[model samples]
Target: YEPSEDALQVEVDTKTIPHTEFLTYVFTDLSSTGATVALDWAKKQIPFKIEFDVSAIVLADIRQKLQGEAGFQRQNWEQAATFAMNNGGDLQEALGWINNAIEGQFFSSKTFNNMAVKAQILQKLGQKDKVLAMVPEMAGMANTNEMNNLGYMLVNMGENDLALKYFKINAKNNPANANVFDSLGEAYKIMGDRKNAIKNLKKSLSLNPPAGVKANSERLLAELGVVI
Candidate 1:
């Protein structure tokens, strides 16, 4: 394994030991739990190799074990949920894991974050009403700064429409804040709504925002060929 290159080169002499035989032996020895355990052990043995190149069967085994052991722990459940979501192989399974994380604890710190992930999963699953239902809770939990950051984060992730949703929420909640409108404008611009972008950016500037906020609004307006 080359640490700098991040590549694992396995050399085997086919004359002395056939490649097929080696693979067969490895597979036979490392079945379900065995493969998972070996991967875990390898992570400990090999520094810089956080993830292993294992089969889907081994990953499924690990996920199953994690779910079974998650019992009442918000972080554990959230971790399992995140892993399932990142897997992207089964949206229903990801939804189940995130639901488990959300319901595991009544007053957990991870509850809101879990809800956000659930909303994303729901959106992917085409559950628009359910995703919309979560907006109040998510928006209520987030402050102006947090909401602004989240909206931009979604924009960076190319989720412009979803980002627009949060930006609208922030503008509604913090009507007096110039930054909120600025963020809303940026989201609208990314969503290709030039009219709304100009409207909100103009609103932001009119609010007498700080220099940075004023400059950003002006810049966006300039990009849209509107010098307001």
Candidate 2:
């Protein structure tokens, strides 16, 4: 079966499957790729062939199954958390599994997704305070673009104050990066703080941001009626 749109394909020998076993093995193996992908494939392609319950394949259980897998444990945990969050599974359980993933030795590679998923879970669980408390940790784990995107997400969620907190942490952690300040300036703009907005926009421009950031900063300044 070819999962993706590309030409790569996977051949499975169905002869080994007993009638009762059916597609359970295939479902479980596909889950190793991700529960969401497995569920999507099952729902769309093989509706009745798979008989497993979604809730039974818990994030906690998947976390346990992924233990001591050599180098891929962190990635597996991250995928588990993502699946739980996306598939209407338990949010609190997903939070724990994702925290485990983040604390794993190979976390840096999965940092962005881990933090993003955790923040989303926290928000969904009405633990917005925890999201704020995660600013420092997020700054450490997530890259500049990831943090910036999270901050903008908060802004879109109308949590301008929380967005400010995230942007501030990003700016502190990435002092030389222009996008951080640009995002900070944008957050301030959304919060109706013209002084700080203009301040950070100027800072972003002074640091020689990329063309997109430069144009955005210039446009914001112009809208604020400030001559650059």
Model 2: per-residue lDDT, tens digit, 1-228? Answer: 456777634433323222342333234434423432122232233322323566556654775776656226677777777888887788887887788778745553446667777888898898888886776666666677887887886786677887798899889888889989988998888888999999999999999899999999999999888998
**Total clashing residue pairs per candidate?**
0, 0
Per-residue C-alpha lDDT of model 1 across residues 1-228, encoded as one tens digit per residue? 557796564433223322232222122234423431111132132112123544466457757676464445667656666665666447787777677667645524544577778877777787777776776677678767878866765676566787888889889888899999998998888888999999999999999999999999999999999966
Error of 1 at 17 (Å): 28
Candidate 1: segments with Cα more than 4 A from true spot: 1-72, 104-110, 145-169, 175-178, 187-196, 202-219
**Model 2 spans with C-alpha error above 4 angstroms:** 1-72, 103-113, 139-150, 153-159, 165-176, 222-228
Which 10-residue span in candidate 2 carries the lowest summed lDDT? Answer: 36-45
- Residue 132 CA displacement from its true place in model 2, Å: 3.3
**Model 1 TM-score relative to the real fold:** 0.53
